[model samples]
Target: MKLLEVKNLIKHFPVKNHKGQVVHAVDDVSFHINEGETLGLVGESGCGKSTCARTIIRIYDPTGGEIIFDGQNLATLSQRELKPIRKNMQMIFQDPYTSLNGRMTVRDIIAEPLIAHKIGNSQKERHEMVAQMLKQVGLNTEHGTRYAHEFSGGQRQRIGIARALILKPKLVICDEPISALDVSIQAQIINLLTEFQQKEKLTYLFIAHDLSVVEYISDHVGVMYLGKLVELSESKELYKNPLHPYTQGLLASIPALDIHAGKITDKAEMSGDLPSPISLPSGCRFCGRCPYAKKICAEAEPPMKEAAPGHMVACYLYS
Candidate 1:
């Protein structure tokens, strides 16, 4: 079942000292995540992947479009109205150092969600629940008294995961959850998240710049560029047959030693800096740097259309 559906989602930030100019963080983007499946969103840094995730989770109010979660439109809901719905949704932020509370013990940090939603009846009850969550995330109950700073980066992330899952949220937005950790530690975190998903039957919107990690964990993959969803397809299909030029360039940039050797056919290397979001081009956002850009690519933008079965791309070349 589709657990979260975002349609034509738009989020724009006003440029400082520039009247009437805005940074188009996420513009007319759309996708969905079904229950118990993972949807990985990948793009270059500053491509609005994190912004899309935040807007979906309501950290930032969307500028336009619909956000439907479990059949309810959340775009226009008031904060009071959103509170109840938030229990079924949670986010694991990118930075573990800043995401957790240092002043609070590990126990209180994990129990905050429970307290906010009034889950447990008594203090002792909540403590037990926190303890169980700690264990589930690979921490001991004794560590509950320690501060977030006392733990390593990996352990702190585990605490963050425990906090997010304490409420048993149906949808979890993992915003580059493993970006800050060591290479060795990244695998552990990924495995932990995978284990929890299977056990809890959770759905994930995993956002990252690392395509390798996204491919390993995601059932479907969506490629974004300059606030637009350029392409989307099943994980294997996207890696095997990336239609969009941007998607092809992204895959080519991946180290050749990557497990999927000889899979990428074309050397669609991207050049030049990304176009500024504040003053976007009238045509395709990637036209400025695309190697295969034609006159039509500069004349008008292309809408996302299916180029193959289960594969969608937004480019004039496909049209």
Candidate 2:
């Protein structure tokens, strides 16, 4: 059974312009993650990858559509009603430095989730669990006694991971978890996350801008453009055979070594700026930058159609 299902999810932020307008951050996006599977969401900054992750975790209310998790529609659940459900879902924010509370000790930060969920009876038991968790994430209990500021970037992130995994949540939303770290640190964090996922049977909605990293860590990949999911397929298939022009352009940007010369190849070039989300062009969201966009593409929106089994795309060319 699918552990998480999102249908036509829309998240728009209202802004007051000359006339009240909405920022189309996430629009009509739909996808699902099976039990213990990782779904990688990749797009440029402000393409709604982070917004989509936040909405799924109910950090922001959905403007429309359903966020079905574990058979419950989380979008409609009230704060009071969603309390228990929050324990099953956790988020590892983008910036490790900002995500941790500098004022609090690492132990408290790691134990906070358990307290909020009312897990483990007493403070002593929670502290004990924190010690165990610290060890699990390659941290010492003595380190947990110190403040978050004392640790390096990599260690702080490990603290964040320990906190998120403390409750053993079934679904985790990793919002560019390794983006801010050094290249070497990034690999360490990725390996740690992979280990935890296997041990816990966790499902992940991994949001990232690096296609290479996404392909490495994901089972399936979803390409987003201007808040809409333009393409989705198994990670290997999506990298090998991208159907959407935007997906092709993204993959083309990856540095591929020329075996004969040991040099990088040409990147797929894109022209024009991203259109304002508030006043998005008619029809396809990517038409403004898509090389293969036709007149019909600018006239009306194209529905998501399957070009191959288990591979979906939202582009006029495919239709």
Candidate 3:
């Protein structure tokens, strides 16, 4: 079952000074997340990974597109109409330090969702729910009495997890949830998320810059370049054989240890910086930096097409 379907998702921010020009943060991006599966979205910074998540969750009004969640068109729902839908969906933010409330106690932070949704019958009931959630996320009940600032980065993220899962939401959007933590703690957090997903039958849309991390957690992976999805495939298939140039570059960039030879190899290096979203190229957004760009690539954009079994790529090379 498709839990969430985003079709032709377009999100644009108006240029500050330009009258009609807009920043194409996300344009014509499409993907879907199946029930109890993870869809990992990977992209370089400023490629609109976070913007896409935000718009799908209705944090920002989309410029155009369809956001269908649980068979309902969330893009057309009013704020009041979205209240119940919000209860079934939750997000764990990227920064543990900034995402949690420093002023509020851990108990309060975790209870906010329950309070907003009126899940508990009374204050005592809510506290019990929070305590159970704290334990589930690998934190102790006693820790709930302390403020968010009192915990380490990993612990703080655990609190964020507790908050998100308190509602028992069917869909969770993990927006780079493990990026800011210590390297040693990253695995632990991922393991915790995995455990919860299995236990709760959760569907996740995980966004991250780390390809390895996404591969570990995602069932399917989508590659984004300059606000467009360049490629998408099964996680294992994508790692074994990346179809798009941008996806190949990303996989190559991952640091690998060569114990026998004592050196790394197979890094597909590219030249040039990312172009500004406001003044994008006329044809392919990635043509500016793609090493194999041809005259045709500069003259016409390529549509995303199936390259292999369940593998999608948008490139003139495949077209």
Question: Scored by CA lDDT, what does every candidate get?
Answer: 0.94, 0.92, 0.92
**Please, what are the lDDT tens digits per residue for candidate 2 over residues 11-103?**
999987646789999999999999999999999899999999999999899999999999999999998999899889999989999999999
| Candidate that beats the other on TM-score, 1 or 2, i.e. the better one | 1
The numbered model that scores best in lDDT is 1
- Clash count for candidate 1 is 0
Per-prediction TM-score to the true structure, in the order listed: 0.98, 0.96, 0.97
- Cα lDDT tens digits for candidate 3, 189-288: 9999999999999999999999889999999999999989999999999988887888877777777765464222454666777899998998988898
Off by over 4 Å in 1: 258-260
The TM-score obtained by model 3 is: 0.97
Task: Give the top-scoring candidate (TM-score).
Answer: 1
**Model 3, C-alpha of 110: deviation from truth (Å):** 0.6
